[model samples]
Target: MIYTGFMFIVVGIIVLFRKIYLELQNIKIIIKIFKQQFSSTYRNNVQIKKQKHLTDLSNFIPLRSYKVYTIDQTTSLERLYMLIEKAGKTTKFSFSTYHDDESNKNYFVIDFIQPSSSIIINVEISKISHVLNDKLQELLSIIFYSSNTIYTWNYLSFPPVDFLIYDHIYSMNTDKINPKNFISLQHQFKHWYNRTFKHDENCQQIVDFVDSDGPLCSCPYRPCKFPTDTWSLSMAIMYTFHEHLQLNENPLEQCLAITKLAIIIEEGRNRQRIEALRSPSIHT
Candidate 1:
């Protein structure tokens, strides 16, 4: 009996130690993953900061300054107003116009007026697109819980008609816009903006056309001039539309895929603009 008890105690100790060891190994693996993620994030942040600093410095000392023409204020304002009016008919939303001191004097401002409990639309163009995507997802979740309509109250509203001309002038003068990729970039933006505001069946149809059928067949309008592709247009719509719907937290992989795609779109825009400026016409 004594020998048997001793044997049992020893086996119990062995089992406990094995269990502890496995738990410790799991903890170590988790720690390593966390460290790697932190390191990668830190490096990315450093690179972004450096790039922004360089851009700001370049603005001060112009090697080849490009001209940026202001948008036709009256026309831009009218277009924005019209868009809001169209969006308001289907959704319960309103618009209020506000003018900042600088914008009031310089540019037009149209506020997408909403209730106090309404979801506010905040676009952060400065941050990396990936970060912005995550932020947008979070914002949309919050908006979904609180309000039905998401309002993007513009701090500065420029007319849609003058968008191309203004971009051309800006690219030529300040080197801000890229002439070569300007058309594609604008198309991407138009699709993105439409996806954000248009959430109904018609919106989905447009999204499908732009994303899958190619740009030529994607635009529903009679004279669709913009380039729409299955990837860009559909992703934009999915990202924007999903915000208003109830979300599940389990499919983290799917969420990440969407976020990554958004980042890709943003990166493409940035690269295209820069490449356009490097073209022979700009050099001369």
Candidate 2:
């Protein structure tokens, strides 16, 4: 009788394991179905929005032109506004009449990511296409360029503008970055820095300041190293933007970090010098 009872228990255990495996397979099928449905709905919604915006533009555009943008963080907006304000100050022909015209909107695209959403303004560029070139994608690209944000906020194209970027451009706190955001942010930062600041005057000065004993700030530190000309010292602050792995609010500390990067590059050059000196046969 004892042997019979043991045999029964073993059979029950085997049946339970089989049932568990079957249930897990069913769960996997269900999850796959849900993801497929979600993806379909998201694409459909985006298409509808694009169609609606395009329909609205058809009425206003003379040559059947359209413009769109997806903007992010506060700095991106600041850069946008800086251009718009300069346009306003310079008395851009379209700036004054964008709003007064019944059919136009002056400042479009003012969505925010997290903390900066609260401060976004709702101004439009109602008459930009009217006064400026009908094709704004090329011009907006130049004006809205900056390293702080990841994507382009200006498009001189029609709806379903897949090539155009329509995402938020927020400056992460730099201390604690979301892993997904950090990856894209790091990539965009490198691309923009290389393009924009490669020949910037302040960037050159910061390189000099670290090695040549230049002034620490506007006023000389009196005993400074890494010195260079102080023509556009203010731009050195932008170097901090690229130093994402290490960011501090204090501009002075950021300047120091910039100095350190210059130090690393300079050190590399010195090492090459030393190696060349030791090897008479090798022309570096």
lDDT comparing candidate 1 with the true structure: 0.35
The candidate that achieves the highest lDDT relative to the unseen native structure: 1
lDDT of 1 by residue, 1-284 (tens): 99999999999999999999999999999999999999999999999986764453211111122222122312244433444343343332211222235333222122222222222222212222343334333322332223333222221332333334323432212233222211223245455444333333443344534443323333332123334423333333233222111123211112222322333344443433433433434421
lDDT of each: 0.35, 0.32
Per-residue error at 129 for model 1, in Å?
A: 60
Which model scores highest in TM-score?
A: 2
TM-score of 1: 0.22
Candidate 2 local lDDT, residue 202: 43
* TM-score (all chains, Cα) for each model: 0.22, 0.23
Worst 10 residues of 2 by lDDT: 91-100
